[model samples]
Structures are given as structure tokens and as C-alpha cells.
Target: MGTEVQCTLCPTECELENHQVGGCKVRINRDGTLYSLVYGKPCAVQVDPIEKKPFYHVLPGAKAFSIATVGCVLGCKFCQNWQISQALPEESEHRDLDPDEVVRGALYYGCQTVTYTYTEPTVFYEYMYDTALLVRKFGLLNSVHTCGYINQEPLRELAPLLNAADVDLKAFTEDFYGRICGGRLKPVLEAIVTLREMGVWLEITNLVIPTLNDDPKEIRDMCRWLVENAGPDTPIHFSRFFPYYKLKNLPPTPIETLNMAQQTAREAGLRYAYIGNIRQSGENTYCPSCGKLLIERIGYFVKQNLLQEGACPYCKSSIAGVWDQT
Candidate 1:
């Protein structure tokens, strides 16, 4: 049982008894002490653009030190990074970086933020939480890219260190979540709502796989739910899905599907919807008020920025997102 200690990290409030692991396979219960085994031991680390995290809203055009550890709570059939996402701590190699060392490394690399990414950061909850706290102490912000499978108690406990989050709503239907992902949909939705309520800058990513979770009606429904819960101005990235890992028989998501998804979200009242992983000019940011090109991006690199102190330079309308240039 995950009941020996309190664990509401990401919807999986796996209370541990003595000498057991939670559903995520990283957190451990050792003789009544619940310890996150992956703490201070990052299995992976890299430096990347902030937009690569697909967080176009948080500190755009900045560098973020991205890190992750092995293990994941949800067992999705089509996981792109299953080698690490499904591997145990021993199964994957790790760097000898501690939480404090992580902060120092980000600073050394000229990164403005530390991102808990690559794999499910929630599975490595202890590592991410400790590192986030230490990273924030150095004045660098902490962000997370997660599937939003967290419990309320643990999320609140870690909120002080959390700044921004890119949570995947995954799919709208519980059937997709249960039959395909071996998880429930309610908790993911709850985590999104909780993150918003906790004042975390929230962005959403929905991977539209062909014949799986790509029903246009369902996508529209999901967008409506986001607009209702996360607000219309919230940025939602309709990511392109490729045939990878276990779902290789299917071809990559068509560009047209991505465009349609974007239009669907915008029609549903999401003002900042985007189509990701495609090198289209439409990827550039436009002023929501005046349709002026605000920030131009080519792939992950920023080409031109027209924001004057966080407001659109053309219309002077207040844009959403944090861009303090710190």
C-alpha cells in the first residue's frame, strides 16, 4: 500500500506502508519513512530553449536547464520516451548532480530557469521538489512539464517552489485515459484546476494522435473545457504526434490536422492556441488585439520580438505571460 506516509504529489496520493514503492516506482517507503529515491539523482539533464518546453508564454526566448529522472506514473502505450519513462532507477543511467549542484549548473550555463522536464517530473517528485527549492534560492525560476497526475496535498506542499507549469491534458475522454494510458482522467483535470488555483502560470499541450485521441469533436470539447477552467487567454499547444515507440504503424500527424486543431481551439475561445512541431510561419505570435506580429520565431529560436515591456508595441494591449527579462 502507498499508505505508510502521505503522498499527494500528482493526483496519485499513494500512501505507502513500510517497505514499498508507490505507483510511480520512484518514491519508496522504507520502514515507515517515505523517501523519494530519485532525490538529488537526475537521470537526465540538458540545456534547451524555453519554447522547446513548449512554454511560449513563460519568459519567452530564454534558456532553461532541463532535467529529469527515470520512472512514470502513467503507462501510456504510445510513450515517445519509453526507454526512460518506463525504466526503473537502476535501468537508466544518471548524473551525480544533487539538488544544489543542479542550481549551480543552471547558473553556470547562463540559464534563467530550471525546468523539470524530459520525463514525468512528478515521478521523480523528491528530486524535482528539492531542486526546485534550491534553484529558486538562487533567484532562478522553477518550472515543470508534467502530465498533471498529482494529488492536491503534495501539489500545495510544493507550490511555494513552483512558478510555471506545462501540463498535458492528454485526452478528454476517460476511455482514452483508462484503455490507452492505464490512468484516470478526473485527476489530471483536477491537477490542472488546482495548478491554476494555486496561481501557477499554466500552459496546456494536447498531442493529437491519429485514430486514438484525434476526434475533432473531442478536441473541440477539450478546448471548451480548457477555456472554461483555465480561462480563454490560456495558451494551448496542439502538438503534432509522430508515429513513435509502440504506435509506429500510424503515420505522423498531418499538418492539416494540427491546423484544424488550432482553429478548433481558437473557435472555442482560446485566444493563444498554437500548432507545435511544425515549421510554419503561423507559429509566430500575433497580437491578440490588433493581429500585429509580436514575436517571430523560427523553430525554437526567437527571430524578432516586438513586445515593449510586456505589452504589444503596436496596439499597446496587455499580453498574457511573464517576460521580466530577468
Candidate 2:
């Protein structure tokens, strides 16, 4: 079998012929045409907190109607959602929720956003892009929790409708991304730059796995790069790695690591840094201009909201996030 057809969604650019799939198991070449088997097909759907997306910056505390299709473009060894993220279209249980149905569900669930999450939306491009167009007209924001792994053309086209996106900057080193994620680091960086340049509200998540991608120097480098490329105001969530999927033998990331990561980010010039999947005291979201808690969160619950007209009510300093016009 000669590999000839090209897939430009990521840097992989897997060339393939009929009966062949790209580096991602989901995209296939059938009789000379590339098609996504997951299109218009959803395997999981629910309403979750925008905070759960670790998007503490956008619509904080609002419920977001979330959807995910089976199959992932990049196969990560420590995938937390591998059950849904790594499966064939025919392998997972699904709901026939079309774009129209998705809009209805968001409104029904009293959600202000529809999140294409739990898997890489880039692989299911048509399904997500079309759904985003429809949902925006109904006053619903389109949010994506993505790996930032896509070609510039598709990313530019989709950036307009996106109200917010939480992109994962997996690691700073190419070796980590190449070996673990089955992806390249450069395209992900490019996509993040393009998103910020396109004026899309953005957040970044870095899942620190022990002995894999968690070098203090690497984390510092990642944070520095984020501040330089995506802007210092971009919210960065340093999520604690829980052993799952193929990483069952590794112990969960310690609380100290998450805190240290957040501190490193702050020291590196990130204005808003957070630690996820851990319970304990954390100094999250203080006014960059004046030290005051703008939005205090502990374990996914918003304990205090100190914003008045999107600015800190205490010291009248401007906060860097979208606040409801309440």
C-alpha cells in the first residue's frame, strides 16, 4: 500500500491511500476521499461547569453543555479520558446529537456555552465547526478544550466563532510531544499564536505527569513561552496528573508539584495561574494591579466573586476576564 493522500490537519501530514488512516486512527482515506467517521456523531454529551474545563477566565461558574466524539488524533500514553478520547467511531456508545440538537440541549440545560471537549475537536473538524456556527446565533458561546493541534488554515477559519478556548501546551520539548502524544510541538505553538493573534479568548492547560513532562526547568520554559507568545494575561491551568489509561503504575502528582508549577508560572509573568484536580489551600486569581481575590475558587466551587462591572470591586483594579453583566 503506497501512502499518497495528504492529511494537513497537523504537522504529521500523514500521506495515505485507500483503506489507510492518518497518524490519528480516526481520519481515513476511502476510495481517494478523506473523511471523518466521527462527524455528526457524538459519543458523549453533558452539561459541565466552565470551571471543569479549567476555564476560570471565561463565564466563570456558568454551566456549559459539553459534547465529545470518539477517536483522537494524538495518542497520549497518560490520557485521562482515553475511554472516549481513544476509540474508533464504531467502538463507542453514541448519541445521534446533530448540531441543531446540540443548540437545543444547551438552552434546555440553561448553559451559556457549548464545549467541544473530552477529545480533540480538530479531528472532528466538520462536526465542531458547523456546530459552533449554529450555537453562536442562539447567544451561546463556543468553547473548545483542545490540544492546539491543527493546520493554520482550518484553525483560522474556526477562530472567528470561538468565544474562548483552553488549549493544552502538552510540553516544551519536542521529544515529549513526539514520543508520548504522537504529535509535534511546533504546530501546537503555532496554533496558540494564531489563536491569540485572531483575538480569541484563550487559556492554557499543562498536565504535569511525573517523570514524563514534569521537569521544573521545562515547566518554566513552557510558562515563559506562553507569556511571550499568547500574552501574560492568558490563564494557565497546571493540572495535576492522575494515573489513568496507560499510566496506571505512576502515582498521582503531588499537591506540592501543582503549587510549585503555579508559582513558577506566576514568576514567569503569567497573570492568572491555577492548579487543578487537587484539594488544599491555593492562592488563585488575585488582582494583578492590586492584591485582592477577584474570583476565589476551591475545588471547582466559586466561593467569592469580587468583580463589579468586570473590575475588582475592592481596589477598582481591572480583572482580565469576562464577567457577567449582573
Best by TM-score: 2
Residue 208, candidate 1: Cα error in Å is 0.6
lDDT of 2 by residue, 160-273 (tens): 989889999889999998898888899899999999999888999999898887788999999999989889999898888998988899999888788889889999999888
lDDT of 1 by residue, 1-326 (tens): 43478566655567778877887888888876777778777778999999999888888889999998888889888787788888888666888889888988899999999999888988877778778878877899989999988777777777768889999888999999999888889998988888888888899999889889888999999999998998987899888888777789988889888888998998999989888888986578888899889888899988988888889998899988878745
Candidate 2 lands at a TM-score of: 0.95
Whole-model lDDT values for every prediction:
0.85, 0.86
